[model samples]
Target chain A: MNALLNKEMRLSASILSYLFIGFGLMTLLPGYPILCGVFFVTLGLFQSFQSAREANDIVFSALLPVAKHDVVKGKYQFSMLIELSAFLLMALITLLRMTVLADSSVYLQNALMNANPFFLGVALLIFGLFNAVFIGGFFKTAYNFGKPFVSYIIVCFLTICAAEALHHVPGLQALNAFGFDHFALQMLLLLGGALLYAALTWLSYKKACENFEKIDL
Target chain B: MSIVELKDVCKTYPAFRLHDVSFSLESGKITGFIGRNGAGKTTTIKSMLNLIHTDGGEISYFGMPLSGHETEIKQRIGYSTGTVSWYPRKTIRQIVDVTRTFYRSWDEDAYRKYMTLFGLDESKKPMELSEGMKVKFNLLLALSHRAEVLILDEPTSGLDPFSRDELLGLFQTLREHGVTILFSTHITSDLERCADNIIYISQGEIRAECSKADFLKNYGNPGETLEEIFLRLEREAKS
Candidate 1:
């Protein structure tokens, strides 16, 4: 735990440089899926890329008196911390729009409450898949710069493009219609997303630890 | 008793391999790990620290197995590499503040003492410091925790002679205070001045591990230095 705290503090130094701009963009995006997409893609890939460029990042941490496994745990914890913060900030922005824009206040609030969970569910899936590939690949090679990062960026770009395109599809509209209006369905979506996020996160953490332990610095 | 021991440690890379390296550093002595570039000195050190996973063999530090007691053993061990580690943008103070939280036995007074002695500016970032200054800063961090054993990789590569001498003097002082020191460097003169023991590695294998006195006595003739002896030995090993 102490090791994780120390690592988080170190990671915070790197993450702070990107936080403001990432948060600002999150606040600016009005559409739910797009906002979540941008948030997940930008925060996730950017931080991982920052870490990769540091090259000696994991080696430096490994030299410390902490367990290597704790280093992996710290990374997952830090990523989740950023994602959770973005989620909260987006929620706040949605609230502000609900109250300040009175004409669409009820509609926006209703849309946010009902539709957001589904979008976040989709966000969870994307974030989970992104981490599995990124973390697994990064740690496995002990961080080679090009392959993992650029590939993940392409994946994220394609995912966001596909989701944004799907928003207008007539067939999926029926599913979105129910998902965006029903409280129970939205809660289910949120729960399901949360579970997927947690599971992928744990799997990534475990995978990272295994890969890192095999690395000879 | 030895403060650190490596028994038949093996590691492999695509281009290089460490072949069953074995050595031991007794407590409160300075052991100079010497070799040419890419001769497995750093690989041996990294394997002992478990930073580089070993394919075979065992390493023990402070009388405990390295694998089982990594955290505890590392707590007593201080290490620095050739390059400055940590974020380049972070000020010395910021890095220190963050790093101090990892160790329970971090000595604030020792830190302040070294920081003052080194004339390290708390506000300056790592990249702003000269290479010599960076090494000193890293030594300060390693020494600040009252570490029982210090392992450094090429700690005096790019420094002026005065800075190198001062660092060597500090190593002697720390040795007198009962801290074991193991450092790898190509600079034979530094080791000649302060090393109690010399461990020579070449071509991924340890050629010799002996007291400095025995090394000069055995391999060196009158007026021959460690540099000359190292060259002769390396040539012999190759032949």
Candidate 2:
């Protein structure tokens, strides 16, 4: 497993993937939709997948002394590694916005989604959805990725819109609390999102292994 | 002893089907697997390795079922395709670094020996090597792992005569050291030079499996080469 993951990092990874991890800093943008950072991170991973496919990385890995399922596992591990790295950065930036910049007028008066636990939860949810939809879909044929990515984009944009609009609903404005306001509810949402991300990624891994096993090559 | 065995292996596709193909490779023998284009040679090799899921079959390596013992079996076997187009940007050293970790039996000395023997530069990437050098690099990796069985598909396809002869000589040397080889190729001359056994496939079915001498005696006319015999068999099949 370690060998396979090393293969992914050294042979299959694209430079864009590392560069895009910095996109998590976009959370500090006061008036912009912070969740777009998650989208860009996933997009960077998508580039890795594209380059891997073109290089016949699947065939190369399958030739190794590992089981076919291990190949899928390695890919999932690499994807999650990238996602988690970006997530950590986003989490740190969110922490800064919640404490250090909480009283700043720019963030206080901002109409966009604020950097809080709720936003972090949504970011996790988006990462989970990308795994479930994009990664799982790519393994179905292990060749065609366009349709799956398109489907994920549609679902992701819709989720982002809903997240941006959720706080505006009557009596639900507390979901978007700034400066750790409604801290318990925000923490609960964060916990729920973490759990959902784990569940979705696990399911995606299972589904990818099943689909890849059926392929002839 | 049979080091590799496939019993009634079956795989179906929209346009082609491998119909109950079966064969076994004897230990310490050079067996040439010959078939024309679209004749299921690659399919058979892939099925044996479980690179492709067969619809129905029993495949075993060293008497253990492949399904339950894939990694163990694969550890003892080395497989290489005809081309070397994967990981074109990574240096051979980088690829070898990743590949060597998978095998507990990896021998650095043997790797160094073969790298020198094959004239492969560790700093060079796959794209930097010629077709023959790429194939040799593939062979170096296989031999580095100290595999008991080597299954190669068209390893000599694109090489010049001198390179092909060198590769055939390497096969002879490996065989002398008790390596079991299943070599698939279109070049009958290479097999004629080194192969002890022959397994012929046509239209996804095994047409013959016997010693090279017996195959030649039964199928060839006086003074006929293996290539002539193969062409004759192909012609007979078409008619």
Candidate 1 Cα outliers beyond 4 Å, as residue runs:
A1-3, A9-41, A92-114, A161-174, A178-180
Give the distance in Å from residue B70's predicted Cα in candidate 1 to where it truly belongs: 1.3
How do the residues B56-168 of candidate 1 rate in per-residue lDDT, one tens digit apiece?
Answer: 99899878999988889878999977675566777888778877877889999999988888889999988788888888888888889989999998999777898888889
lDDT of 1: 0.74
Extract clashing residue pairs from model 1.
none
The list of candidate 2 runs beyond 4 A from truth reads: none
Chain B vs. true chain B: TM-score for each candidate?
0.97, 0.98
- Over A21-55, each residue of candidate 1 has an lDDT whose tens digit, in order, gives 35534543443444453444445545654653573
In the range A61-146, model 2's lDDT, one tens digit per residue, is 88889888888998899999999999999999999999999999999998889999989999999999999999999999888999
Worst 10 residues of 1 chain B by lDDT: B81-90
